[model samples]
Target chain A: MSDLSPVPASAVVRVDLPQQPYSIAIAAGLLDRLSVQFQDVGLTGKQVLLVSNPVVFKHYGDRAIAALEAANCKVTTAILPAGERYKTLRSVSKLYDVALKARLERSAVFLALGGGVIGDMTGFAAATWLRGVRVVQVPTSLLAMVDAAIGGKTGVNHPRGKNLIGAFHQPSAVAIDPDVLRTLPAREWRAGMAEVIKYGIIWDRELFERLEAAERLDRLRDVDADLLHHILTHSCRAKAEVVAKDEREGGLRAILNYGHTIGHAVESLTGYRSVNHGEAVAIGMVAAGRLAVKLELWNAEDCDRQTRSIEKAGLPTHIPLALDPDEILAALQADKKVKAGKVRFILPQHIGAVTIADSVPRDRLREVILGAMGNG
Target chain B: MSDLSPVPASAVVRVDLPQQPYSIAIAAGLLDRLSVQFQDVGLTGKQVLLVSNPVVFKHYGDRAIAALEAANCKVTTAILPAGERYKTLRSVSKLYDVALKARLERSAVFLALGGGVIGDMTGFAAATWLRGVRVVQVPTSLLAMVDAAIGGKTGVNHPRGKNLIGAFHQPSAVAIDPDVLRTLPAREWRAGMAEVIKYGIIWDRELFERLEAAERLDRLRDVDADLLHHILTHSCRAKAEVVAKDEREGGLRAILNYGHTIGHAVESLTGYRSVNHGEAVAIGMVAAGRLAVKLELWNAEDCDRQTRSIEKAGLPTHIPLALDPDEILAALQADKKVKAGKVRFILPQHIGAVTIADSVPRDRLREVILGAMGNG
Candidate 1:
């Protein structure tokens, strides 16, 4: 991304929820000094249940525990097997066992130290553990740091759908260390970029234009630290602001589901194996873009521009050829977001804005999905 | 028990939290008119997932379904195996399957139609399902109607502890039909009385005196209709008031756990099979009374009075002689209420009052348990 004005000295966004407001701290070495960051959010000398996947744990778990121990916390690490398939109640039940063995009190903190899956599961555990304890999120992946880790939406998936079982328990604080991205896989880097592109299209036009200016938006190495700093702050700010307005998704928050309706279906239908969450979201956004244009809700030119950004991020801009259109339609009905048996869609009216459309014609949905298939 | 003042015209206690305030309606034949009652609370034409145990399902499930269907709700029944042993995350997972198959939306309702175990698991399922949905508690047992059903405390037990995994999800409405108690087993009837006695000890002196006025508090049939109505209203009122002031058990709510501290340990040590929740609470209250008297926080006479109430209810006033006192003490350290490694006990200051004691000395606790052993 193009260089912007001087990055703020303090890159923290406050999610001012009515209850349990928290801050997201973004810096390069935040992970190393986690204990200090935890204290900043009022967690200290408490039992900490640090949950992370094996991959992330292997890289940063020791440092995270060390930092927490520095603050006099009794740290217990639960290294869950990495991947979406492992994100279930069974994994969360294991966390409960760890929490009980550690004798974690209601004042104790659950520190989620990985990607969206880790954050979601850990947060769900904290939310339900003793009717809820404090949770501190140290998001390792870009998707988690900017979005999943910031908002209080934490849950595990049901066999039938994505994130079907969860709660709105906000973290005490969200600590983000961009340095962790170096260990993230290339595919994961691109998948995260998809969510970054999502914030650009749905909330911030300046963010969209800046990503368009970048020479390469595919890899973390392609962007310098300043742009990375800008991306993190802008995206976190957008998400924080939206969540502050609607913590429980009662209203207004539905716009954040711009691509998630079909995205979730795609992920669920694939059994969360072939297509990851971000990739599915990217595909869903493309289909939504085409549908918006067909309904004359948005100009085709803006839709193409959005497509260009997704492509530049090296994300899929079309549905996988193997996923049946009819099945995808059926999966959408099973989505947790369905209200009064109506499938709701969040469609971009233009860059930096989206609207919730509840009655998208089934035929238009079918046509757009078929048209957006890979190699169509 | 002696009759209350004209049964208060209408036995409805309002749990007025800042958000999602709901009413607990207590009356005879309330279960038969559940559809109308659900409609009163603004739940109509919604998808309903009715959760119950097999025993309760056999007696009242059809009528419950008929009432819900009459209100134009699409109802699905999930009959779980009865007993505390089945109160685990695995049961909640089955509910998730049922919820998914029924396509329950955010606006949909989960109606819990049994005792505490059913309500706890169903409420937990509702709490996490799609992040959260509305739950309507139809408590069949006296225990659930007074305590478990009114408060939002919903959870499944961890293998290690009671209610170690749970959430505070306030129900949309709690409909109690005292008429259902006719089908309740004598032990269950006595168990429910234990909680009613709890209300007397912790907050309502008049309630305690009323039970003392009764010649028989051991069976539902032994009590007259007016006294039954008073028990439901007064107990619900006490729970509702405490929960409204302290929804998350931050302070005042801990008083509600008056007998639960030691009671949970007894239930856990006995594998939740030997001593049920109410019976355990009865035993716990007995132990708590002795501990309070020994510490000089409460007088022996009032402690004996509390014991007499438990005896009148046909509830156990002493720990099982078969259990080890040392092991019971060890289990206390693992309770969810333990803060900073200190086992907090709610000790009675006097009848109708209790105080939270954080540092109950280990030796003293051991002596109290040993002294309270049955036939000691």
Candidate 2:
């Protein structure tokens, strides 16, 4: 995969918002070639609001801004602090202030040039300012290029809840430049691989099998820009297809939240500071897999394959910090998915297949969470 | 329009959210029949957090609570003070505290049971609580039923800006019973008529003609159940259809804020204490129309028709008391629709036509505004 012999572009993932159908261009040099996606979306170089954070600015933000500017897109930049904790109304106020200060027109496109936090906050600001505007996703990180950039879940987290305030605002185009990931920290790179592996486990077992075979991920690593692009293209297409069918997370979209239930709680428990989102979700995937196995939805071998790939990719597949079962359970009760006081868990029926089970008994859930933590 | 004999079984205008198709039930008994909309939107006889204020509660709170309870919806009512000054983040925080205290779950729906102030505050709370849940719009005043209820534009005003902190969160369902307007004061009802007249001038000339012909809104004023439902049905459908097609308000939605450009500034200048939302927007409509004639987009006769309709509705179509044009213009600069440092105004092309023009010269705009204030 790392042999950069001019990789053939795979199918572009189309998020079919019939009202505003857009393609996610997931490949290396795609950011530099953003005009293609914009052309496909029927938009020309207009005023663009480029949103990124300081860390991402230090990495790929300049490249992104330059690329759009090169494409004749009028661009202005605002760099925010990087972190999930910063995904707040107050934090997003920085971007709103910039847009206001820059005198951005209603038709101006908001180009998100960082990770999921930046993307979510930027998309939301775009959604509300002057009622709404166009958003273009130029995701830099592996996690953002695939998961965050593809779906249109734009929001800011409340002090009491993750993504407590949000809107389902779709982007006009997504420019996923995998080349930017070369500068990513090793931990974040590995963490992002967890979501890459997640796409395979939840939808395409073939992809998972390929990942399992690639024990040493350097072949699949960000250093190899073309190979990295291929990975993002595949992952983004899978996510985009799902989002297309259900833009508002009514049905198929929930499948995408496979490991996020427990993952969200873990991040919240640790104040979203200790572990990356993907790493926390990696642990969540393992826990959900265990629950599925206990419920006879999957066999031991399938679970073992998950374990190997997760660990091999250098991602955690177990819970941490001896958290109280009651606290986790309480958070579960407070979960946005909790309906009728019942916890909703997305469990794997088998590798590449999942279901939203809303009736899982609390005691049984507590056992699965405790068992997963003990395994660590 | 008042001589209606047999009204349909339901006058409700339903918004078909593919996954959750909820209704804007416009029957006289809708406030009493809240369960129908709730159940249709997948909100069963679940817990309801009713957010209202003392003014509404002192009048109809007990009956509203009883009506909801009779339907087996576990109702927890939070009565706040009735004042525009109370529409703040601090108020929203209090609302969140109330929802937290009631332990609102995902299935639970918040019933906004008062006027615009209550609806805005409660809807903002619903938009942010536990990352959002179902919000049932039971707007009591004429302003809310026609303007705010169906739009799904919910938020709390920031000190620095109005509606700066908000989200486009659609209510699970809107239960608009025009019966509630019977108890509303004439001043409040006239304020709502401004929106009604504005909508007519923009969308339906026939509606405009009807208002122009009505010497006294006896049909509307007497609160004749059948006639009132007919009136609300058209209003709700007009707003809902616009919203459904453009949920986030990219372009077509801008038409709905026809008079709000200057209207909002008028409110801000007065500290929200003197001018009501509808009255301010009414005056703003006159101001915008004057600019329209100046820009040669609208005729003087069309302006007279609109101004006369507003006056007949018992609404203010002229700028009120001692407001300096420069101060108002500064406030207008801070208007949410001021993009690229230019205020985007929705001006009428003719009596029945509206176009969003962002290129109005500032000096010319200030001239029209000052002239309307009788101090140019």
Candidate 3:
């Protein structure tokens, strides 16, 4: 948005919560040099609760600890097990124990390090410990730093569904260093990219074009870091502006769920193991677009353009049998966004704009599912 | 603050979290009459996840199920084991499993219809489920309705320490009916009364005098419903107002920990079973008073009055030898509130006013402990 110039490391994307307004920082390696950053945010050397798992602890814990220590700030660690099931009340227990062992005061800071799973569980832990703690996220994975880390949405998963248990506890500051993704596996990297691309379809088509042109553009070998940074900053700003206006997903915020309703059902039915979050969302996005087209909100061209982009990024674009359209429809019955059991949508009319509506009829919904499956 | 009117079949204390605040309604006959009151809060028919243990569920679950059904709301049940240990990830798993079976959506609510343990664990489960869902507490215990139910705080205890895992998740509405306490044991009733009496001494001398005049305020039997409602409202208002201003407890909220610093250490040293929260606070308050006097921050007369009041409430006014003061201090060193490892105190200068200062010296802290044990 600012002519692709590298912004200051302190450049922040704010999510306005009058009770606790927060900012998200996206830079190449902010975590390695984070001591000074904490000061600008009014966060003095208070105790910080660092929640992560074994793998992430080994990779980034020591560096985080050193950074805090450099600033003369105290930090403690709670390394939980990795995976989705571990993102439950039980895992929160272990985190609580560690904080208790550290004697975390109500004013202590809770930092989440690692992937979406770690951030989710740790954020939920912070959301509840002593009613709540000031949470700061140091996301180590691309999927986490770009998507999960930016939103104040934090929670553990109920076995019934992914992120079935959670809170809207926003972070005080998010120290995101995209360089952390250098060590991530190709799959995880791609999963995060799916979300990055999502920003293009939902709010800014220029982002989509840039992402589509990356392969032919200058940066090579790995994903273009500059391109990545630009996308990250813009996407974060987009969500931040909306979140600032709609702290809770009550109105404008719901449009950000461009691909999450059916995506959540897919994740739940598969128990979050069969598909990575982005892949499920990729499929869900396609399905939602088809539904929009069926309802005459958008034409087939919009559907094809979006699905092709997801496919080009190596993301899935079709719903699987793991979830039946009927079941997803049923799950929608209880969505927090539903007013009187009607499913809501954040569907695109074209590449440049999206619509938030609940006008899709039942028969049209069925036809959309069938069309999305290319089945009838 | 309002004139007594036969308790109105219930007493509702509104804890305003204007940013995301919900109300707490403490009443009688809530189990049979929740449907009507819930409608007053913008709540209509929706799925309800009733979380409780087998014992309480057997007695009240059927009635809950019947009530929700009459209102045409879908209902599901998740039963955890009846103990503190079950307040782990394992227990939350049961809730998740049931919620999944019922296909709970974001609008779904979890009803915690039991005592403190159930209320805490269930509240946490709701807080994390789907990142957050509405929690409607129907506290059935005197301890819960008077203390746990009144606060928006919800969490589970960790094996390492009590309330190590939790969230400041306010229930969308707390349906508190004092009639539920009829089943509580005498010991249970007495435990809850300690907190009731505590409000009078630390903040309201008038409430203290009233409790002192009661023949069995500690036992909590036949303790005039209106007086109890008055006591409950005063304490809740104090807590709710603090929470409204500082939901995350940054600075001004620290005074709420008047006796918690040392009391927490004592509880940790003795494995939490040694004392209930109110019991610990009773002694901690006295200890804090003496320390305040020793530091010349509080007058001796005020400390004497506070001590005598605590003693008269049938609460412990002395620290126990079950733990060494050194070990207690070590644990205090880990408190999230401690800065550079020095413990702080909320010392009262007089009734109705207190100061949160960390000027207490370590040698003085040790001496205060010695005096609390009658060694001075």
Candidate 4:
């Protein structure tokens, strides 16, 4: 981690989808320069609806509105309730009301301003409102900036399952301001590292090694600016490259769901109360690593190395002791990715490489999950 | 008008979207061959959810289920209430429940078997189910068979407006069985002719002449079987060709909204109660024709010809007396096609062609709408 060279002023990663190509701009202090950025992306002189939650709005909503207005764009605001529980069709319905009240037209722009929940709901609103309009993502959390915001996978959860209802409506642009991390809660900042670590294990080896070289990975305040910039830019670039090749998750894009299979199961099993997304993904990655080792897809040394990285980021490396492994397995079977009645897993072959394996024996899955629980 | 000899075994109109190319099959007795057709489209041996309203299901559900089962596909049925009012997110939530209960995976197929309402809701469900799944539209109503079923536009109505929530998710296949029309209500069957007339006025002059040649265009039983098949095939082919050239309604496809600009407003102002979709579109086409004639964009002779054609089809050519002209204008301003505060209208240039006009003077619009109400 000794490379202390100054990062670029703003790193741009292009998501090259033929239908609606867009770019993610990673930079420091982008909120103030949002008007310029949006103008650069062809969003000026348009009707823009800025959607955010109360918490996020209190921090940055004014800046976003001012930026858009300064860009000569008409701006309207819809503030939704905060939390994962609020990410529902009901909430999205409220956004539609605001859009209609504001008279948002087909060419209007809906700017999502907040974390994954806000971005997902706003993007979905934009996707469905008037059968789909343009949406620009302004992710205010590390979790969203690196992962959720970059991809156009926008949706709200159903009572029965997570992301059971959604549309693959890509955003016109994704503008990330790293300065927002300073205000993000410590838990959310750590939750984001889980995804950054995920990029390392599945796609980028140098990123994996850098996390290992870092002295501390507990909070945003502890991480240097240069490393944070690199983490944000590299992770966005990796996700962009994968999504560009397979925009609809037809084949190559499923690799991005490396930890999400078990991770989503864990989140659902816990009723989304105990573990945040990043924490659940961290725990899922640990179990996936163990499963990879048990299936002889990867070595124990690589598994242990992955576990240490997860722990270093202050993320949970195991499932909660109270949760039943069988229930989790049931949830896994019901996951969207389950095909032909078989649960598919993206298992690591080594650092920075993984393979999608649906052939993992059911008995081995039970063993690895139970082992991750520290009991059998 | 005499070209239709036997109307091929099944006329196939390919919607050539590069990302997800699909076909719309128009046939006379295709309902009995549903299983074979679905299998031919790569839907065999998979989990299929057949969504239909109780009314349509009462007549066709058993056959569809039997056919799918015969093809060795696992089939689940979700019977919703029959009405445009029932097309809401809540109804879609019921479908999500059915999908989850059926354990529908990412590869599961959702087959819509009803009118436009059922097809729209079902397709919307398919679009959002696990981010997106394969959908086969089995349109029973003539309106759906000709217009709604051919386009990939799927949506549900919001309290604020009609079709305010939707996604552009193309179907894997659209199987139109003309035999089902025998059971369609007289009102719905007539409503569909408005769209057929629209295709004529916008792109097909021969089709317009064919309608003029028909003796009676009021009811399905009154129309000859050969002409009915031609209407279904020709209309589907026209829509497919337009959607193929512009899948997203970016430029060339806006012309498809010929009567929809004012038609949708009339539907919304009526609370979607007083007028069925085709009736409102019929009225809007009358008003649009008048507007075009008043603006000198189209001659009065062509406009009167269009009115006579709509009248011949048993469609209302005048706006409902109870609807306020101002309210209709306001609703038109709120339409999805309104760009930059201007309501874009697809005005006719002649019998078989139209042009997009956003510069229609407001006073002239008011005069034409009032004239259509027989008050000017």
TM-score of the second chain, each candidate in turn, equals 0.97, 0.93, 0.89, 0.97
Model 3 Cα shift for residue B255 (angstroms): 3.6
Provide C-alpha RMSD values for all models, in order: 2.0, 3.9, 4.3, 2.1
i-RMS of candidate 3 = 3.2
lDDT for each residue of candidate 1 in A185-283, tens digit (9 for 90 to 100) = 988888888888889889999988989999898899998787788889999999999999998897888888888888988888889999988898899
Clashes of each: 0, 0, 27, 0
Score residue A276 of candidate 4 by CA lDDT: 91
lDDT of residue B358 for candidate 1 = 89
Q: Ranking by DockQ, best first?
A: 1, 4, 3, 2
- lDDT digits (tens) for residues B191-230 of candidate 1: 9998999899899999888888988999877898877877
Among all candidates shown, the one with the greatest DockQ: 1
Better of 2 and 4 by TM-score: 4
- Which ranking of candidates, highest TM-score first? 1, 4, 2, 3
Docking class of 3: acceptable
Candidates 2 and 3 compared: the better one by lDDT is 2
Error of 4 at A192 (Å): 0.5
TM-score of each: 0.97, 0.88, 0.85, 0.97
For model 1, the superposed segments whose C-alpha errors exceed 4 Å read A1-10, B1-9
